[model samples]
Target: MFFGCEGVCLSFGGRRILDKVNCSAEPGRINGLVGPNGAGKTSLFEVMSGRYTPEQGSVVLDGEDLTRLPFHNRARAGLARTFQSPVVPSTLTVGEAFRAARKSHRPYLSKHDAEWAARLVHLEVSWETPAASLGTFDRRKLLLACLVMRRPRVLLMDEPASGLINAEIDELDLIMRRLVDEYAMAVILIEHRLELLAAVADDCVVLDLGRVIATGDPLTVFDDPAVREAYFETPDA
Candidate 1:
């Protein structure tokens, strides 16, 4: 099965944020979405996640159309996403956050689900700890646990490795690979951190200025001259 966008287009105030971008994530595969700042990677994610309807194109999952579905419906349709920043409710406790995520897909959170999610993300805090009380790295892990608790068909992760130590990043990378293989789901990861993306992604898609500039093997795509030019200042305009 696969999930992807075809000919997606989005603009704000007459300025294009995404322009006819196309990419796919196959089951049990990690598709890395990378670009320099203002590259519209996140905007492309918004179009795929149904946060913003695209001006043109479709969001497809296993051959079904999801372009018009709202965020909740998309989640119900087996879509889950994590933001560039953690979005766990500050008032909710560690366990509550996990429970809240599961509540959308199930009436009650099972012990197995809780343990699986907590362990998957290497969650360490007590169930009683307020989510806000955790540090940035731990907080990100907690939010990741919340999303993974649901076992969505398509996972959209935005900059999940930000603010993590080398060890934690390594753990995150391993966990992501395990999750994809275990669940057989399509995962699109938008990350600025090249090392992490290179380590986790099975394939790579490069987006620059709202357009897909390159797509293929992770190492090859990153090494493309266009990609280098986007990151490093070139003498020629």
Candidate 2:
């Protein structure tokens, strides 16, 4: 397994969220996390990235325990994640962000490596364009490119399709597919858009009210009666 979470649980205040949510991500596979709003998908992503420690269970990466590692350590240990909201620095250019990530990790790498990474993510823009000037979709792509340059073994993405137009969503999907195919990275994508998720994910894990409701092929998960009911049925009085 590239990344594994077993028996993970988290709580805030008096309520429990993400109860024993077990998941495994393997290289070259995109695992989709799908659920109704407030189902704890983002919380699980946070836990995987070490933003929040789980109250119980373990996070293992490549057969080693990573439950207690800090965010940067986890990142250096071949883990990368994209935020639900893009956090690219406004002062830097898109190219600079990618270059900085490589420099931070492997300061001695030649300039060719940095250029290669930007090209890998389809970032052919001028190096001098300030990041603040990028459109929403380009900013998101830049963040992805920065993460990919690190060559992480696993990636955690939160709602990658949100705020993107249909055409841009399609473009982003193609980029993600290329990453998995070319880099063999394990990807965990948290998405509310079912159609896009179904198109990309090989398997889907459905969470409802912070628990695993179902796990299987995307078609099965989407067609499941429980999934539909949880997402659409009227609540019982």
Candidate 3:
């Protein structure tokens, strides 16, 4: 496994949020993590990314144990994640933001490197444009470009397709494929959009009420009765 969490457990206010969950991603493949709202998908992401310390189990990347490392240290170890909202510095221009991302850690990157990363994601806005002025899709592309500039080995994306129009989603779909097929990075996606997963995911792990109820190809996993029930169940049931 290039990136994964094993036997992860988390709780809040004495209520279990995750229960011995195991999930992984492989290089050159897109692993889809899907479940209904409040199914613990985002919570598991927090544990894997070191934002929340699990009560048990560990987060591993390329055979190295990172259970105790902080989020910055995990980023240094080639693990990068995107949040549900695209956060770009409102005070900085596109060029300034990219420069900061380039110089964020050791082995500082160059302008050419930043340009290459921007081109990889088809970010065509003027470098002088204010980041806060970008539209939703452009903002997303900008953040993703920044992460790619660091050359991470694993990318965890949370609801990346959210708020995107159909046309924009098509563009994102292509970018994701390139990230896997061309860059060979292991990509794990947390998404509610099943069509996107069905089109791109190599495999999927479905969680329900803090437990994994199915694991297989997207088509097969989506077909599982347990998964269907979970998705369709009434909130107050």
- List per-prediction Cα lDDT, in the order shown: 0.85, 0.86, 0.93
- List model 3 lDDT by residue over 1-237, tens digit each: 668999998999999999999999999999999999899999999998999999999999999999999999999999999999998999999999999998898889999989999999999999999999999999999999999998899999999999998898889999999999999999999998888999889999999989999999999999988988898456564
Query: What is the C-alpha lDDT profile of model 2 across 1-237, one tens digit per residue?
Result: 569799999999979998999988899999999889899999998899999999998999999999999988998899999989987888897667766766776444556776776777777678789988987887887888777766789989899888999988888888889889988999999998888888899998999999999999999888889998987567889
Model 2 scores a TM of 0.94
- Return whichever of 1 and 3 wins on lDDT: 3
Rank list by lDDT: 3, 2, 1
lDDT of 1 by residue, 100-132 (tens): 766755456686887888888788879899888
Task: Show the lowest summed lDDT stretch of 10 residues, model 1.
Answer: 100-109
Best by TM-score: 3
Q: Which stretches of candidate 3 lie over 4 Å from their true place?
A: 232-237
Query: What is the Cα-based TM-score of model 3?
Result: 0.97
Candidate 2: where is the Cα deviation over 4 Å? Answer: 232-237
